[model samples]
Target: MDDTLTSTLELAADWADRFAELTTDERRQLALWLEESPENAAAFARMRRLMSDTALIDAFDKGDAPVQPLAPLPELRAGSSRPARADRRKPMLGRRQAIAAGLAGALALPFAGYWLAGGQTAGSPPPLRFASRVGERRRFTLPDGSGLLLDAASRVAVDFSEGRRHVLLEQGAARFDVRHDPARPFKVRTPHAGMVALGTSFSVDHLAEASELRVFSGRVRLDVADQETRVVPADRWALVHGATVSTGSFDPTTHPDWQSDWLDADAMPLGFAVQRLARYSAAPVRIADPKLASLTFSGRFRLDNPRQSLELIGALFGLRLEKRKDALYLA
Candidate 1:
């Protein structure tokens, strides 16, 4: 191997060692490093795969014991499409094969970058887009010291220029912890409403036909498309739909706690709860009985595992759950 490739592999190994302990700044630096070259990304992927192995993890957890490296990866000739059928069955990994696997991992990084940065290229300029898939949440910092938390199945497009920082919430939900910047106001634009904040912490949920805004701290000005502008203070929320804007009270004790990975619902409709849960659920949850959709549910549910949460909800409501190949039906 060349000196550059060897150095990159060593760096990848170091990152794998500290992957779980890396701070936000360290993660940013790692992202920047991956952006430097395709080789670096490939090397990081190879090391990450190795670190994620069940045997390696178990060994690490068992204490300071040296782990026996598993068999090396399969080999492929230069300009080959893929390994032959016989080679695919082989489990051994040679030194050259290991290096090639690292390169393969690097080649996959660009596709993985979509989920990491909402489709935005790391260390790239704006007009960037970001998205989170089902059963996933992402937290990242903006160039302006602002922090953003994207809920599952959420998407947003960002544009930051000389004078303003603008974001369009395309779908799902997101929380913004804005940094104080008097010169450039932070604005979030939804389908039917717009929000402007000077320095505040707020969350926006833009689901089908409805957009809800909740202010956790500081204040925000809500501008509905055809309604009067309203100032929402801390502990308040506004719901916008079509041409109507309704202001309501916000009780943190009962609202969905995204920060804690819990959904604390108080008399929330079953349909709405299912809708929210669907974002984080791998399988589609369907209500077989239309009337049951209006039933209200109140409780705190974990968001990390949607299937378990659904089972709990089913038990609470005494609802029957039918499992099929494609979806879960509740009645």
Candidate 2:
């Protein structure tokens, strides 16, 4: 093999072993590398298939297989037949190849409340669920190169089957930077809305009474019950409440800053802003004056210090803050 092919295969093997464990930045690097060339994507796919093959996993489990280095994978071209096997002699697996295979096999074992009741087939991996508590955030990448940034008080379920990537946003908010695959559409399903993206970066915020979809780049098709599909383009958003779909503009810079550990409000209602801050607050925030709830305020507050945030809000809005045993009241 040439130097380029050898390097590509090595990188593929490395990713196969540590894909699930990669940080958000590391996953972004891998995604950019994959987008650099069609050949890279194909090579990575081949490496993943070899690593996940059940026959190799079974052989590894039995521990009686011949100890030989793995043969170099044949170079494949689009629409061309796979090269025939070199010979019947089994080659020993390389260290990286061995590690990838071992990891794949180990992942097949049941995880706590992650796997379905029945065992999953060898070809299909079990669904993985992720969640973040109040004031906490999480970031991870899916198998298909898509990345997710889950905000505070959020939960998501990810499933990648043969031809689709499905994600269920149970609550709170998440941002998705999706990898484009025409063969498989990335779909995010929320309680009040569903979004389908061919390739896009977007955010979904699901609250108790409504859901919001924001498109930062590319286009998204939003569907609400019995309503016409709303196609939202870049720098736009839609709010879905019951069966109503309301579209609006969103400036990326002025958007909520929860991902950056800040709550940003641009002339947002005081009640709504307080509710948003409550997600990161240690104590409940109450508005003693009902008339003060609709007062609009614009500002950015740090999520790490809820008390300070409340203080800033009080100073800005000229409201009085009262500390109680059960809650912080602002009148």
Candidate 3:
């Protein structure tokens, strides 16, 4: 990396590290800094993007020594207009500003930018990680010709060892289309569940509440210890939430194609899909009624158009839509 880019990254890291506690003056200074150039703003965005990566965060947490206690969060005043962050998804260990900045510096420049798009070192090795940024999707093919279609803001770590092909879903969602090699088993895992492909294509989502698996073709076996291993075939789905496993079947034809840019909500929670759509919006999109978040909605909604999607959702739910200066609220 050049000197100018390096300097800009350093500045961006400083701001990102202290984002949760920026004073009014600091906020003004940051605005001034961002207004200085477009590159500066982009650099800051990249910083936050990397900060949100769960794999990079895993690496950061592992590298941290003599762990420190986290400070308690300040209470939100009653009747505050700002919505609290969703408990289902959040950047892990994001408060360790010092460690965050230091580790970010220690890692190679453009950690998210270069690595997620297939940057290689002197010798391309195992445990390669690929991630997509917020509101963006990415596709990758391995050396063995296996295809990976990564969902928006998703992260995955791949380890192609001599014995097995392993992929860990650190965060978000991903679809794996395996290149059949009976000699080598293909495994996909999240923090909660594990799967061994039966030479098939399947998708895994690491949501805040649970890990979901939807199989489109062939089969996948849930192969976790002490649990009854079950085979999930085409049009079948499975969910793992805190050691509890649930199974359901759906019509493959009616199920929205995962490859499309639109969201196929098959009885999905409103909050979850809203969280996904919020990435496309600049202002925070919040639900006025907390109870509505858990309401399930099954339909097709376009991802590219957040405004239209919100309007449709509001109409369906019989909620009022109000666009405020601070946020877009569905009441």
RMSD (CA, Å), each prediction: 11.7, 11.2, 17.2
Local distance difference test values of all predictions, in order = 0.70, 0.71, 0.71
| Residue-level lDDT tens digits of model 2 in 192-291 | 9899995799999887667888898999999898988878999988878676777878678766567677777766568766766777776788888878
Q: How big is the positional error of residue 53 in model 3, measured in Å on the Cα after superposition?
A: 13
Q: Model 3 Cα displacement at 61 (Å)?
A: 24
lDDT of 1 at 296: 80
lDDT for 185 (candidate 1): 93
lDDT of 1 by residue, 1-331 (tens): 3444555655666565566777876676677677777767766654654443333343355643333333232233334422222345346543333443443343343434432223245554435466777878877666577888989988788776557889999878999999989899999998878999957999998866678888998999999866777899988888786787767776765564666788766666677677778888888888888788778888989888777877888888898777887788886
Task: Name the TM-score of candidate 2.
Answer: 0.59
How do the residues 140-179 of candidate 3 rate in per-residue lDDT, one tens digit apiece? 7754578998887778987774567888998788998899
In the predicted model 3, the residue pairs found to clash are none
Please give the range of 10 consecutive residues that has the lowest summed lDDT in model 3: 68-77
